[model samples]
Target: MMTPDEMMTLVTENALEYGPKLIAAIAIWIIGSWVIKLLVSGLNKVMDKGKVDPSLKPFLCSISGIVLKVMLGITVLGMLSIEMTSFVALLAAAGLAVGMALSGTLQNFAGGVMILLFKPFKVGDFIDAQGYMGTIKEIQIFNTILKTADNKTIIIPNGGLSTGSMVNFSTESTRRVDWTIGVAYGDDLDKARAVIKQLCDADERIFKDPAVVIVVSALADSSVNFAVRAWVKAPDYWGVFFDMNENVYKTFSKEGLNIPFPQMDVHLHK
Candidate 1:
């Protein structure tokens, strides 16, 4: 081993030899940080000009900035005269481990990105997906929020929604309302059809173009079932459905029609 004084001098010389590279790395880091900020700011301006969704903008900007800064850090490490090969290998290994550990979470993140970009649905839309039906309340990076018709809040993972089939009812301008009305077998089928047709004509919500269909649907043990189908604008669908039910009952009653109820004849064998 060398003397203490000799070792000290050698150590000082090594540090002096690498001192300029270290200084350069610091300089690059500081300048690159500012450059990254400037680039992120410019990107934000471009995205804003594109009129992207408000909720998606900030997340995209943040992810972009982080990626850029990570690349800049790698560049700085190269300039610092440090052995970057081992560092890169270690980083790769760490990333792989983390990715494996958080596979489910990463899937959700990817799904969220797809949702933001493609916009399969949006807030306030009444949707059915993954066996859940509700109005979307909010959408976030990991999950989506929903409010059920019964006023219950539901949180759904983005991964499931992104991969599953979804039905957005609110997107349609019109929907069909269907109901089966039962009448006594002895009642006049022709007059029942006329009365239902009159009821359909009187309803303003029912669309006139496609027209309404009223026909015998099935022969039940208790009565003859007549199916009534009408189309109405989506916004007025529920209202129209309830109103039609009430109107049909009243119309049948006023027309002296016999509404049938299920009956069973009981017999005892002794």
Candidate 2:
């Protein structure tokens, strides 16, 4: 209903009022985006310098970038005079719903964070947890991947892994190998002990500082058990264990030591 000239004047007035705000909003968006990129890059450098695990670095960088961009988006929305209170409330409600629906997933995420921070175990380390034993192949946000000795792949949820007890075999540089050797009760106990000691001493992989222990641990009905304990490098544990076992068997056989087996004699009376 307004005249043409009046319409033109109104449009002019509105443009003059809004033009600077629009330009300022655009400038803020551009500057904010650049700043966010810089911050993300700087964060990556800092994490690298701090020696963050290789598996965690990419995940952390991605999360930081997303958070910064989201904050930037909210700021830009505010600059454009969009109603933020309702939007924020909607976001909170949506987040609450998602969180409730994915409670277990959130726990896994938290567990992942704890793992990255505390470093209970790393990739390639053998660990036993949650009734499974394997070498750690990959550590993800939700689960950890393991490769078993038989080449089976297992995926364990991080939540359970974080809470459960874990034995990391590779944590220490050295580990003790324990073994029990049994000989017939009729065998010469002193001669058997001497041969066992000789076998352990000749093995180059066994550590000598702690000294190998060969002791008569138990005397059973069928045989006498000798407990053999030795220390070896963590990596050398399996090799030394198998080697010593074979060597002891061969040496005992050549030395005429009798290895025992369980035997039961049954007599029937008619």
Candidate 3:
């Protein structure tokens, strides 16, 4: 056993030997963190200048900086005589547990990154996916948000979206409008076709290149069905659909065309 004076002297010598190292370790960590932030910001600017995908830049920079900072932390801890192997073991175990617990969430996050990079749809595009049709409002880390035509907000997981079929209605600049009308068999087919063609010609929103197709589609027991297919700018699709529907009925009525009502005839014979 050492005397009191000897123990005190030993303590002072240990402090003198280790205190600077401890201060250096802490200073390195704090300064290294600030430096990492600066580097990441500069890297983001470089990526932007290179015209990298905007959505991917942030994730790449953040992940790269975090990995570098963690390595720096380990290096500093080792310099301070800390047990680096034990810290690494703890990190590995925690990572394994987190991976197991958050497998689905990680999959969604990965899918979200893919969606952002590939840009299948953008904000304001009307898309159908996972049995929902709506305009894309936001793209988040794990999910995408949409606003439906009926004014409902919908949130869809990115994992489901990635694995399903996506129909983007707003991808094309032009959209086709097709409407079917049924007229009584007694009404003149020529007259019905002429009315539809005239209606198409009168609409300013309708495109004339493809030309309107007003043709007899079917002959049923009760009535004759005709189909009017027209092309219009995508922005005018809904307006044209509504206008053509109303115009067809009004024009047919004005021209004395007979629109048959649904009816059934039942007879009993003895």
Best candidate (score: lDDT): 2
Question: Candidate 1 on 81-197: residue-level lDDT in tens?
Answer: 657899889989999999999999999988988887788998889999988899999999889999999999999999989999999998878899998988899999999999988
Higher-scoring candidate on TM-score, 1 or 2: 2
Q: Summarize candidate 3's per-residue lDDT along 1-270 as a digit string, tens digits.
A: 999999999999999999999999889999998989999999998978876667679888989998998899899989888888987999999999998999999989988887877788888999999999999999887999999999999999998898789999999999999888899988899988888889899998998889998889999878899988999999999999998889888888999998887899999999
Off by over 4 Å in 3: 1-43, 49-56, 71-90
| Model 2 clashes, total count | 0
Provide the clashing-pair count of each candidate structure: 0, 0, 0
Candidate 2 vs candidate 3: the TM-score winner is 2
Alpha-carbon error at 19 in model 1, in Å?
Answer: 9.8
Clashing pairs in 1: none
Candidate 2: where is the Cα deviation over 4 Å? 4-23, 105-118, 264-270
How well does each candidate superpose onto the true structure, as a TM-score?
A: 0.80, 0.82, 0.76
Model 3's C-alpha root-mean-square deviation from the true structure amounts to 4.5
Compared with the true structure, all predictions reach lDDT values of: 0.90, 0.91, 0.90
**Lowest-scoring 10 consecutive residues by lDDT in candidate 1?**
47-56
Give the Å error, residue 45, model 2.
0.4
Clashes of 1: 0
